[model samples]
Target: MSLYETVREELLRRVRNGTYACDTLLPSVATLSEEFGVSPITVKRALRDLRAAGVLVTIRGKGAYVKKQVRILRQLDMRMHSLHGTDISLISVTREKISDPSMVSLAPPDQMMLCVRKVISSDGAPFLYDASYLSSNVEDEIVDEFGRNFIVDALRKREIRIVKTEIVVEAFPATGKAAEIFDVPNGFPMLRRNYKMVTTDANITIYGVVQAPFDRLACSIDFPTLAMEI
Candidate 1:
């Protein structure tokens, strides 16, 4: 790696590892230059790249500080934008009977289903927790594959197609597992998105709940322009 790139990555590592907390000032360019054994110009270039990536902000005459987390979620596509520096980890995978009436569409209430939970983090801070219920088939294989990949991707590999999807958004307080994952107060506000995905068989095979700190996630919608009748 180039000198500036190396410097940038090390700085990012520090930020993610909490050496530099959110909204806290990072060491000055001279300090970083001396520590990294590079020139001030190299350090500046590194900091500039980090700032451009939305990871840090430079205040005139004040230096750069880690920015507060804000990940944009494109509601139409249901994907996060600008997630270049995030990590996904599987939390748990288990087989359980479908007790929720709404989930019976996936299978009979008495039948067992697969449950998978995962967490996504940025800057070493956990932001989103996702719990999904899926059809129970090849449960062992699903659990094994999920350790290194997402359940959705594993389902696709098995030729399971999501033909339709519906997402419902709401604000709820964090509690239980979500509260612990986010490390926030029990009553902290959260943005919850519940999704139901129907497969080719017209059965809802995937039902999931994704939650994040209310301020950490933003939703954007774009409308097409139309000519008005004169």
Candidate 2:
């Protein structure tokens, strides 16, 4: 691994293990450089990367701090992976009118969709709430699989391939049902990911919205992989 990345991983490990307590300031760049036997520039780069990774929060004129509620973002590549971790709990599946603006393009405005609701949890505590709005035509194929795996797998079962995708991410305050599910107070910051996928079958499009409390979800990208492609 690169020197800065090695330092970043080590720092992340410390944060996870409580060596650096939540909301507590980390060692100064100079101190870390001296301890790790790396240059100050290298330490600075590591800190910057950690901040971007959502493991640390840096304040101007001060050093970085371990985020009070840190999220270990899952890494994803070109392939769509299981959104939340492996632990999943099926909530409910029902037919509902397509009303969310993010999903309007997936079906006709007047059409009803099969909504699959599920929660992603860790050790029985739920972190992510996923609502997949599928084209009503594939009810039997997807209903059984979405509870155990992502929608992509169900689509593959029907010989369907996703040819294109668009994702929009935004942060909003939790309210009502959202707050109750995440066990957070109303107005707590939350992350929302709106997904739209187009499959080889023109009539079929997959649209989903995944929501999680801000501290419970994050996303990360490996720069080396992208750099290699270029």
TM agreement with the true structure for every prediction: 0.58, 0.61
At residue 71, candidate 1 shows an lDDT of 63
Stretches of candidate 2 off by over 4 Å are 1-68, 76-85, 101-109, 221-230
TM-score of 2: 0.61
Give the local distance difference test score of model 2: 0.79
lDDT of 1 by residue, 112-217 (tens): 7787788988778787788777667644666777655665576678777778787777777767777778765556678887777878744436777778877677
Predictions in order: lDDT: 0.74, 0.79
Number of the top-ranking candidate, with lDDT as the measure:
2
Model 1, CA-based lDDT: 0.74
Q: Candidate 2 residues 1-230, lDDT tens each?
A: 99999999999999999999989999999999999999999999998877655578788789888876646476544444544344778889988976766545444346787889888886566778999877787758558897777777777878889899877778888889888897665677788888878899987877788888888778665775554643
Give the number of the best model, judged by TM-score: 2
lDDT of 2 at 200: 98
Q: Model 1: residues >4 Å from true position, as ranges? A: 1-71, 76-82, 98-111, 201-204, 223-230
